[model samples]
Target: MKQPNEKPTLKTIAQVTGLAAATVSRALNDAADISASTKERVRLAARQVGYRPNRAGLRLRTGKTRVVALVLNIEDEILGIVSPLLSGVAEVLEASEYNLVVIPETPAGDPLKPVMDVINNGMADGIILTRTQPYDLRVKVLTDRDFPFVTYGRTDMKIKHPYIDFDNEAFAYESVRRLAALGRRNLALLAPPPHLMFHRHMSDGFRRGIRDFDCMEMPLGDIDLDTPLQEVFNRGRKHFLSTHRADGIVAGSASASVALLAGLEQAGATIQADFDMVAKEPARFTEWIRPEIIAINEDIRGSGIALARTVLSIAAGHPLQSLQQVLFPSD
Candidate 1:
């Protein structure tokens, strides 16, 4: 309905283009059934009438909001690395008509409930999931519902979809190799929790690096990767003082990386002389140092762009065959 001073709708476009309302609707939606000429006319008429397809109304007709939700599972403190991930997602969405909604995991709720809620409640057309585990519960829920999503990392579920992951194993392994190359023995790796799939990969890479390098590593290191903030720092501080002595160190996350540096300094270990620290993600605090600490930028924005585009294609009724895994190289 066009009010006295209101703009147009699909009905107005249909009238102006001399096409059926259904034809105008389908044309505006880029439906294949609508002829080419009719689509052009509807588009031009829409322009003249200042008409834009109401996404809310379209959702009612198509049973999809055409909105992609980015879910973050930040129940723990170490998982705060997801901040830059949203920046990447926002950049991609800015170039497209699609919308990005964030679904923050509640503290006490089931980890898998948000997926079901978004899909069943029609809050989103698809989702982009981060912090995927080996047997991710959210993936299972979304798959059972036949919903589309892209993961920040891979899962063990035999089914292939869209994903953008980093080479965690290679990065972890090479970090150790670099230390070994520098003649730094007694290495300690501050890794993510074993529950995370990448944790396993990184640990394997680190071990393989040491064995291949013939470091005679005791494997008596603290891998308190993903834990409470205070606990991780406490363990790192204690580990640096008493046992787990290492000349080379790898901090798996930003906070852990900074904590290890601070802990080592407090324990009378001088940087470069006693310990060479490497961070998995770019650290803010390390900027003020004499020599910048080596770090691997997660490129969360590029990963987010990949995820956003995949969800859009899926929602647009395109074949999912083009979807592929994107694995970044280790720095």
Candidate 2:
């Protein structure tokens, strides 16, 4: 009988099963050399003794920490979409022994430093990066080191890396096309920050929409992503008062849409009447304020799951294709 206060180890299980410690270890790990009968007996003995493998011992033996790191910028966290993304990652990892670690980056600090520390210090086996730029330095660093990593957005660089991104360009073009169909001749786009890679894609689509639909883009349509909510409203108000007031508007994000709504209300403009508006947002947010507004749902949770799976597969030496995926919203 095992003592209540005594913790069970390989030696304990071996003693209980009358087997050598090496044999017990091999059976527990399902080594091909261990026969089926012996493996079953060892497993039964381990269960009876309530034996569990020590994580530290396993790591020392396998040279794997079984931990993954997610590096995110403070700006992206402030957008309030990180929760769902994290939920998705957690859901996929819950069934496995691996754990998740988050490293935050400041606006002024070097974003690659945290990732490098995680790799050099053996803190994590894999990494997931968010808020990728067009010419991302982190990509080159990780690639050169042969470290396993996946990105949340695409980089403009020629190097092939695994990434999961929402189809922002297609969403923007479709939004403009819809507005044109409503007989809107002059359109405005409240674009994201200039530094983000997605900004370029959205801008390209907006410009294309203008030319294809024979519509004009408002001079004051482009708004920065970091602009405060009230400031966005103020800008919208001022734009409405201008001689070049737009007949339709497309907002970059849900928060921006809220501000635009406030401004429109103040300007005595009605939705689908004075002007039509379309916003790119999560499904829940669109549902919360629907009918009056049109929305393009961006599935961030799904993106998180894809990113987690890709990084884990890469870390495990799986020959996965350099995945570059872009998800589009439903019509």
Candidate 3:
């Protein structure tokens, strides 16, 4: 009895399920008073009628936007985080009532601007941010506001909030160990930006490994993972031209890794023949790009899933203590 041109609403779902409009609304919202059977029935009717909630109306009633914002540092395509991370976040969000919103912070401006914009505009109920600093202002601001947020990297801020961090320490330490075993005495790390929290972690591990494994440190000058690939390649080319440069390098990011390798090859240094490169595999390209490179896989997809889940849970008033996780890099 419904026109094909008509759109589906709560009333349409209620009619299909033979329930009151109020009951359908409560059930759709998963209110505690609603029975599970009734909720399931309402959901089934919603599916059958192709019903979708109006975001504006839902916000007015629940005082929640039911949106989570992902704040990313828009560096070069070097890290290759956008696609895999989004895929993982989207997979989790598809099962929930919330929606995903990406807020890109360009390298030019104040890093806190995107986060502040989300807060000021009430654009999202929660936030998930990446590229943390040792003394992160963003973490401090979010904590001070009592706003729900989850970081993809850890911070040195005194106020602890929810976070899921990749273990850069282990990644550096392990790469150094492997390279040392292969008799590579001089090593260098293409670290994250010196300002980032993980840079300290990675450098600490690199230094520790050098001391423990008796390897000499070959420092790369003023270059980092966040640097543009073209720049990285240029620096790498110049660096490798010197005969006394590092025999082993811990590659920083995926795109940067490729650039460095190309630079090394262009400088007439054979990869794994004259020197070796290691990386944290943001993607599986390490296997094909250079089979010899020891690219320890970092689960970017899994990190996305964890970040999304933690942010939503915290926004729902969950405590922060149990939500923190640090994932290790592995093959």
Candidate 4:
């Protein structure tokens, strides 16, 4: 038995229960092979000794961490979207002692390197990746090493994987359609920087929307979202004023919608009259203003719950039946 007021550990339980440390560990995990009587004895002894498994030690024995890594291949400033991503994962992890470690993506770095560094160096038990490309080599890297991971987008090569992504094409198309419905034509899209899978998806969707709604499209104004909002607004105001004049505008992201509006306001433009604006993601700023903005249902909370389920499922040794692509459709 453990001495009163002493912190309980696996070793303490092993000694007090007269069982091997491995057996104590197995019992604590509720391994099916352990005899029922032995399991009961180990449990009682663990309670008396106040023993708890050493997470580090257990991982050493089983080669698992129960800790998931959220890997990004972008700068920290772009983490506004990534923050909500983690928020979804955290909601599920809060139910248990499981934890999330966020690793920021470096600018122009090798896509597979950060995660390989984390996994090979033993920093995380599993991984969650975002902004995956259509023919991304990162998927191959993870699979080659037998690392359990899930992604936030899809791939085209013949390999199967787990992922979660929004219907970017549909959402973008819908944004334009909504603007057209308001009888405003000459729609333009302010999209994220090039080279991201979501950017491609957004562009495709925006085009489809134009084709579907028979709307006239303007120049694609791509912006570096990593820059500060004030900077984006200043630049966007100049660009919007000098470049193609648009009667209807759609901001690809929630914050971008706000930034674009600031720029438009600075230029002495009124919304719903001079131009119609819709945010791709529902932004709080859209509220408390005239002409309520239309937005997509980017449920950060649902994302959290989905990530929790994916991590726990992988940890439990169950292959996700198929790559889970749960889309929270925006209205």
Q: Write the per-residue lDDT of candidate 1 for residues 1-331, one digit (tens) a residue.
A: 4677976777887777777898887777768887777777776677677775567887878776757898886556442456677777887765444568889884445768778779768888889987778888887777777788888888777766577787788887778877888888777777876767788877888888888887645342544755556666566566667654777877677677776676667767687887776777633444455244567655666677778878878777788666776565445
The best candidate by lDDT is 3
For TM-score, the strongest prediction is 3
Question: Which RMSD values do the candidates have, in order?
Answer: 4.6, 4.9, 2.2, 4.7
lDDT of 1: 0.72
Tens-digit lDDT track of model 3 for 205-305 = 99999999999999777888777788888888888887669999997677777888888788888888888888887778868857877888889999999
After the best TM-score superposition of candidate 2, give how far the Cα of residue 270 lies from its true spot, in angstroms: 2.2
lDDT of 2 by residue, 114-229 (tens): 98899778888899998788999999999999989999988899999889998889988999999999999799888877877888989899889999999998865546666767
Q: Write the per-residue lDDT of candidate 4 for residues 1-331, one digit (tens) a residue.
A: 5567878877788888889988987876657798878877887786665555566876888776657788864454431465667677887765433567888776577778878888778877778887777788888888888787888776666777777777777777788888999997788887766666777878898888888788888763446544457776886577557657788887777776777777877887777777888776533435545345666656655665676678667766766765577585655
Pairs with backbone N, CA or C atoms under 3 Å apart (clashes), candidate 3: none
Q: What is the TM-score of each candidate against the true structure?
A: 0.80, 0.81, 0.93, 0.81
Candidate 2 to truth, TM: 0.81
> Model-by-model lDDT, in order?
0.72, 0.81, 0.85, 0.72
How much is 210 displaced in model 4, in angstroms?
A: 0.7
Q: Rank the candidates by TM-score, best first.
A: 3, 2, 4, 1
User: In angstroms, how far off is 38's CA in candidate 3?
Assistant: 6.1
